[model samples]
Target: MKLPESQVAALNAASATDETPIDRLAEEAGLKPETATQAVFELRDEGLLEVTERESVEYELTDEGAEYVESGLPEVRLYRTAVEAGTDDAPAQMGRIIGASGLEGPEIDIALANFGRKGYGDIDSGELSADPDADADDDPEAAALAALAEGGAVDDVDADVLDQLVSRNLLDRHERVVRTITLTDAGVTALMEGIETAETVDRLTPEMLTSGEWQDVEFTEYNVEADAPEVRGGKTHVLRQTAERVKDVLVGMGFQEMEGPHADADFWINDCLFMPQDHPARTHWDRFALDVPPIEHLPEDLVDRVESAHREGVGEDGDGYHSPWSEDFARAVALRGHTTSLSMRYLSGTEVGELEPPQRYFSVEKVYRNDTLDATHLLEFFQIEGWVMAENLSVRDLMGTFVEFYEQFGITDIQFKPHYNPYTEPSFELFGKHPTTGELIEIGNSGMFRDEVLEPLGVEHDVMAWGLALERLAMLTTGAEDIRDLHGTLADLDFLRGAEVTY
Candidate 1:
């Protein structure tokens, strides 16, 4: 009997009576697991061995779960604190109970959220009450975490409790296909007959070629049907690929790309957009402000015009907000919340000189915000900012532009709702039905630039502008249910690698 070196090694390691896992077989064979797997498949094809596959599940504690095991679960800590403060008899001030719990920041939220669900306590009207009968010592989730930390059998833990912990991100569950190999009757017979190793070269070597022995050497048979390890070579991320595609689409639509500072003065970000200086969106809570010196270089004439527009009015029928406006506030530096700042620069002749009518400009740029992370929202994301300057631009033109742009990405069922913006008149919030969830998700905001916004930049023509979420569009195109799945700490590598951005 004859076999390849790897196959002979694998066949010898495999047992006829006992099913051996591929890992142990590979170790005994002294071969790479992938190589062993290939050899096993080849042996199976020849009816010399049998292979079986089964799903194996594994659970690992997240960083948060480990922390809870060292300390205690947040809800457990809160309940114990409440009981210590005599809340088991009557409700106590929620703040006092939480303060004594020693839980701070996100931990406080975690405690309050789980405290009620776990039957640990009741919270109502800023008060907390611990259930005396509720046993924190027997908490299934906490017990599961402890059991996992101590390397206990997973079968001893409740499946439902494990699922709950996974939902809470305290545990990560992994599933894999584990293959087992066993020798067949033919394989036993071949071993009894004493199989000999065949000298098969996988690749021709320089020594063999120089010795003129390459022609006489036997080449290994190629098994195209064998399973190979996944090769994830370097490639552009789906998000980046979509962004570049967007750039190509915009450029094809006769729009020039715009570029500017990511960290810039509030003048172009909000002030020049006719946003009130005291508007809630300008506060530090909503924006990422820098602690550097105020921007020193600002167009003096453009600043005067914008200030006049804010203090007085744009035209005869225009009315400015009766809010106090300041140059110092406009000079304050912050990360641009939107790329409209670039539009302001171009419109004000501060970038690429003055522009004429019938001009289109666009930018695909990153913006910063103080937003809570969730399935749909991130702290930083790309914004598809664009505007068209032409004569007598109307709502119809704005709607038509969106229809044309979205059609490029195969999104035709766009919906628009009346919305309000500080800079655009007749503003609309654009939406598209999610491909996976069938929910209408907001994709962008658009409208004609108002007189108050345009007059400050000394623009006489009508301009339609928009600030669209690139991530949201990607979600629609890629059928991604969660924006986090597209890009973030929780991004799914498999989904990204397989997600196709169809034009």
Candidate 2:
């Protein structure tokens, strides 16, 4: 029998009695893993080898995990400190124990959270108690971390402990397919009869063509059904592709693109949109404030008009918040919570030279917020911001626009619930039915700008504007259950690689 050189080597290296891993077989055959893999598949096709695949999980300590392994898990450290502080005998003041524990900032919270969960102690009404029977040295999480750090098998660790470590961002788990190759009876028979290496050409070269030897050489057969190595080539991210599609769709709907600073003056981000100076959303907890110098150059007349709108109202029928609006606060810089700042800038005629009535402008840009990370929320994500300025615009026009816009993405079952926004009158929150869960998810927010908002921006004509979440739109299109799956630290690479941003 004759075979390719790589196949001959693999068969010679494979064992008849023991199943050898593909990696070890490749090492013994002095061949690359991919070459050995292809050869193994070819031999298996001819019933000369048996190939089986098994999935193995590997665990590695994250940076935080390594730190904890070096200097005790936060909970364990807190427990030891609490025991030394006599908390086991009597409840001690939580602050003193925590201070003595030397846990600072986020670590203190981590310690307190896990301290109670590990049955190490109890925290109640600003006091901490330790369980005398609970041994801090026997913590499963800490033991698991130490085992992983020392290259122990994943099976040696408790599953729940591993899960807890993963949830705490202290460990990373990865699964890999391990393939093993074993010789079949046919393979042993072939080896006993002796096999020869066949000279075969997989590709026709220019030299072969010039020498006219292509016809004389045997061409290697291709096994298209073989499990080949995965090639993850560079391509546009699904989110970016969706964002680009959005831009194209908006442009087709007769809207021009808008662009501006990601971090800008609060004046354009909020105050220009009639958000009161003292609004809760303006506080540091909700916005990423910057320490840069205040905005020195603002249109003085526009500022006066905006302040007057905040102080005295827009029209005779309009009413202002009458809050103490401060120019200093408005000039403060921060990351834009929404791309509505671009809308504010464009509508105020500061961008694109004062867009005229019957103008449409849109921006698919990133926004930052101090939001809690969850399945539906992210601290930073793209926002699809847009506005239409024309006379006699009504709620019907707003709803019709959304219908047409979403239909392009095959989302026809959009539901809108009346909501409230500080700048938009009769605001509506747009919801879309999830393709997988069959549940309605809030996708975006929209409404017509109120007189307090539009009048301050010098937009006399009725203007309808919306700040839609780009990630949520992507989630709806991709059938992703979690926004984190789309793009974030916890993103699923497999999902991203396979997700098609279908229109």
Best-performing candidate as measured by TM-score: 2
Candidate 1 displacement at residue 225 in angstroms: 2.6
Give me the displacement of residue 94 in model 2, in angstroms: 17
- Each candidate: what lDDT? 0.89, 0.88
lDDT of 1 by residue, 1-503 (tens): 88899999999999999999998999999999988888999899999999999999999999989999999988899999999999999999777888999999878766776787788878765578999999999999999999999988789887889877876778898877889999999999999989999988889889998999998978877779876666668778888988999999999999999999999999999999999999988985578899999998998988998998888878897678889999998999999999999999998888888889889999999999765445677778999999999998899999999999999999999999999998998999999999888999999999999889887788999999999999998999899998867875446666887888878
Q: Provide the lDDT at 433 for model 1.
A: 99
Each candidate's TM vs. the true structure?
Answer: 0.78, 0.79
Question: 63-96, model 2: which lDDT tens digit per residue?
Answer: 9899999999888999999999999999987778
Which regions of candidate 2 deviate over 4 angstroms? 1-16, 29-54, 60-143, 158-222
Please state the error at residue 366 of candidate 1 in Å. 2.0
Off by over 4 Å in 1: 1-9, 26-35, 59-147, 156-176, 189-220, 372-374
